[model samples]
Target: MAIRDWPEGERPREKLLTLGAAALSDAELLAIFLRVGVKGRSAVDLARDLLSSFGGLRQLLEADRQRFCAEHGLGEAKFVQLQATLELSRRHLGSLLERDAALTSPTLVRRFLSAQLRHLDHEAFAALFLDTQHRVIRFEILSEGTLDSASVYPREVARRALARNAGAVIFAHNHPSGVAEPSDADRRITERLREALALFDIRVLDHFVIGDGEVISFAERGWL
Candidate 1:
């Protein structure tokens, strides 16, 4: 049966409107994005099939254009729409960071950083430059490397911090290997960066190591 044929309270859109988006299943949220289904399937049914074929929602969202477009019930238009939606979500999270003190909103900071870096197949090193009041001055991906490691230079990081006139910075890097534990190299480099930036009166607030579903913080572990 079509989505419209379902009881009003049972409908994906109606249920979202009534209970809230968090109340919906992954398939239901995706069905709302799909808007309509092909041939005999309802939108929710098509969404479930797509999610299964893609190996779940994250895999589907991270799929390349060709792979995503090749799926049944999806094409260029849907790819464009999906990319736009993902970017909008990232920007919204970034905007929230810009408006708040980075230190005070550690959860938001982790979320924003996770959204920015977690999808990459390769490793990336990023920095969040903060003003005197600890508001975000800029967020930048300093370098990207192979799946295992990214080369981070203290001179380059210092240059950017000076350029941004940052009073403090929070460093982050992703382990594509999905291990949030900070390697010894991670600690050494963070210490080097902290020392280098201190010469310019800039503080290194924290270093975060992002994994698949976990984020490890240097400050939280009293490493800083």
Candidate 2:
């Protein structure tokens, strides 16, 4: 049956309005984005088929233009819309972080960093430069590398910190492998960054390794 034919409370849009977005399943949320379905399939049914084909929501969202457009019920228009939506979400999270001290809102920091780096197919090293008050100065991606490694230069990091007149920094990198565990190299680089920044009176607050569904913090592990 069409979504309109279903009970109003049971429809994805109605359920979202009533119980909130968190109450909806992945397919339901996707159905709302899809808006309509082709031929005999309902929007929810189409969403289910697309999710199954892509292996899950993340894969579907992260698919390249060619791959995403090749799928049934999707096209360049949908791809553009999806990308815009994802970017808006990231900017919203970033705006929230800008309103508070980074150290005081570790959860927001994690969410913002994850939103920035998680969707990348390759490894990326990023930093959140902060003022003496520990409020964010800026967020920048310093380097991007292969699927597993990104070359991070302490000197370049220190230079950026100096340029920003940052009092402190929180470093983060993403592992495309989906394992949040800090590798030996991760530890060494973070330590080097700490030592280099210390020379200029800039503190290294934490180093975070972002992976699929997890973010590991050096400070939390007592390593910072």
Candidate 3:
């Protein structure tokens, strides 16, 4: 049914005023942002079409600004509203990240690293910096090569961590061979880095060996 013809209590705009934005369905939320539809379609109809085009709100939010604006019914103005809404969502995610910086266990570290590792042809070692309360401040790529101590200098990593004033770190590197298990070289490098960073009071949370849709943690194996 068209929004204006729907029962007043069930309409998205009205319900938002009475029950808040969180109470609305996905289509209702998008419809409110969309405001109008093209030709014979209502705002809700256009919202449904956009959902089908992008595979739902999460996927739509992850899309590039240009791609969002390129949709047939989505002109620049409507796309800008969608982009602003998604930007607000990102800020919310950032706030959540800041409130809980601690990686806690290996599983959480793996979950966090999988996205960055999913598409890599070579090893990419990264350091995730955490604050005093264990909230993540930022992350940096330390090195990229075949997982070996000679390639990834512990001293260099230590220097960078000290410069950033990183309280804790969770190190991760992708395995091109799609094996999450650590190699002998990988273990040695992690051990050396752990020892070197300890002197600077930089706690090593975990070392992740990322595979395709999988990860192995050194700390979880009692190796770190």
lDDT of 3 at 9: 97
Higher-ranked by lDDT: 1 or 2: 2
Residue 180's lDDT in candidate 2: 90
Superposition TM-score, candidate 2 onto the true structure: 0.96
lDDT of candidate 3 over 28-55, digit per residue (tens) = 8988887777788888888889899999
> What are the TM-scores, per candidate, against the unseen true structure?
0.96, 0.96, 0.63
For candidate 2, write residues 1-224 as lDDT tens digits.
99999999999999999999999999999999999998999999999999999999999999999999999899999999999999999999999999999988999999999999999988889999999999999999998894222478788889999999999999999999999999888888888889999999999999999999999999999999
Model 1 regions more than 4 Å off: 146-150
What's the lDDT for candidate 3? 0.77
Worst 10 residues of 2 by lDDT: 146-155
lDDT of each: 0.93, 0.94, 0.77
* Global local distance difference test of model 1: 0.93
Of 1 and 3, the candidate ahead on lDDT is: 1
